[model samples]
Target: MFDDVIQEDVLLEMKYVYDYVKIETAFPKYATKKALQKYSSPTLLFAAENDVFFPSKLIVPRSEQIFSNLTKTVILQNSSHMQNNANINKILTEIEYFFSN
Candidate 1:
């Protein structure tokens, strides 16, 4: 029964409300301690210094505590959500090392 959906109406009313609820719901539901504990095997977690989604210092410690075989964590000071620049290079280096020897 979804019809007559105007672009502006969706964008202005439904999308804003949906986005707000989604943002509020996502955090508490997703990143739980038990959820983190499920990760097994050698894991490499890369967190950016400027990331809004995941804070490096906070998440890194949890990862270390959770994963028994967590190989390494690379915190890129000059990086954001997307890994770019020398930090990305360093991450690649770490990944290479972890896989190699």
Candidate 2:
């Protein structure tokens, strides 16, 4: 099996996350004050200004209030959840900037 082929210690574990899943599933459990207080870290919460599922007007402020340590926020003025060319480029730039310093 794939798990056996690579040594557990040698293989880095990564999980693909869908934002909708967080909103629907995890949020109910983890979006409480106690949960936020438990896991405090530097966070970069990005929201699309034009996102249909999660608009920046809502998500940005909510994230800022919830996360104990929010490093930055970059909202693409005219973007959606799909991360189109303009949004992708903007996000990529923010990511590069985040890791550089």
Candidate 3:
């Protein structure tokens, strides 16, 4: 049950939250290393293989630098900036894996 389901105010707030989620997914989570504390909130990064803007070459390194509890970095093959996500099965399984542990 949601309040103000389609009202302009609610929609604007929703858009802001959605935008934040989309942006945050690109990089890693907050970083704090007590000399590599070894455990932090697990972050799963799904990068589009054909995405020129945020290629694995850039995402991977940036992730490693910040996320101490990096769970996995999955490159979605054949996917681009606006992916229909052909690898739904793989992606879902990875999400399961992330949640299970």
Candidate 4:
């Protein structure tokens, strides 16, 4: 089980992501654009700074264009895809504030 968690198995930024799920970058030009167009709810996107699977640099830019009703987009600095070691206080603060309004 643990052996399956090898780096070679992990999907890179957006490479070959479409084979599994619809995603943008280095593949079809916004293949999920039409899918997102139907979702008009106020959304908040949080990207991890050091996440290779879905890095902030790659995702946030595309999200800005895709999510028409984005309430806010935040890049969690010094963070990664998994939040095992993430700054909990900061995360809570952001979530609290976003929903508080």
Candidate 5:
């Protein structure tokens, strides 16, 4: 009975994701290599210094290589994958600066 309930939950979740993806397909999807070659717009990368999901060290250099028009990288010091209010404020500030400049 428990297994059946779990399977139903999983199927429901999968259907939700599939529906969401179908709706999202209206936007352009770019492969990393293709985006690197094709994209030529200014871009800013805000990286959390202490992010567990995506380490700054790995993401920074890889982004630098990929983004032809890379503008800047703002490192949010002592931050993790899930940001606090302070981090959100910092991110907003960085975005404002990026757009203004």
Candidate 6:
């Protein structure tokens, strides 16, 4: 899908793409600990145990401390960034439970 979009767009400039990539690379610098610490709303974080991009060990603790309101963190075992059908169902069940209570 992404490849098709890139291929079809004749006017897509390389400079614009480079700039976007540069901004994305620098996102963590602006989206800092202090920024996360300001969150006060209830949050449910589903962390994939095997996800390299957002590791559960690092994110869970920081999230717990950051959110002033009730924060629930579920570490889905044997799951990657893109969850399987079973894991997706599990997440839906968790969301339903979270909302009901």
Task: Note the Cα lDDT for every prediction shown.
Answer: 0.67, 0.67, 0.68, 0.69, 0.73, 0.68
Query: What's model 5's lDDT at 93?
Result: 90
TM-score between candidate 5 and the true structure? 0.65
Scored by lDDT, model 2 comes in at 0.67
lDDT digits (tens) for residues 48-93 of candidate 2: 7777767899888788778878899888776666555555677888
> For candidate 1, lDDT tens digit of each residue in 1-85?
1222345654577667776765544465445557666666678888776676777877788777767777777787755654444
Please identify model 1 stretches exceeding 4 Å from their true place.
1-28, 31-39
Q: By summed lDDT, which 10 consecutive residues of candidate 6 come out lowest? A: 1-10
Q: In candidate 4, what are the lDDT values of residues 1-101, reduced to their tens digit?
A: 11123254343533466567765557455636678878877788888888767789999988887778889887877677655324556678888998888
Q: Which scores greater on TM-score, model 1 or model 2?
A: 2
**Model 6: per-residue Cα lDDT over 4-69, one tens digit each:** 123323335545676676555532642445776666667788988777677688777766665666
TM-score for all predictions? 0.57, 0.65, 0.54, 0.61, 0.65, 0.63
Mind giving the per-residue lDDT tens digits that candidate 5 earns over 1-101? 01112355656877797877666435354338565687778999988777875668877887877787889998877777666667778899989988998
Question: RMSD to native for every prediction?
Answer: 10.2, 10.7, 8.8, 7.9, 9.1, 7.1
**Candidate 3: misplaced stretches above 4 Å?**
1-39
Q: Under the 3 Å rule for N, CA and C atoms, how many clashes does model 2 have?
A: 0
Candidate 3 lDDT over residue span 35-94, tens digit each: 457656778998876676676666778778877777789987666654442466788988
The window of 10 residues in a row where model 1 has the poorest summed lDDT is 1-10
Q: Identify the runs in model 4 with alpha carbons over 4 angstroms from their true place.
A: 1-31, 84-86
Question: Which portions of model 2 show Cα errors greater than 4 Å?
Answer: 1-30
Candidate 6 residue pairs that clash = none
Q: Give me the overall lDDT of model 6.
A: 0.68
Error of 5 at 13 (Å): 16
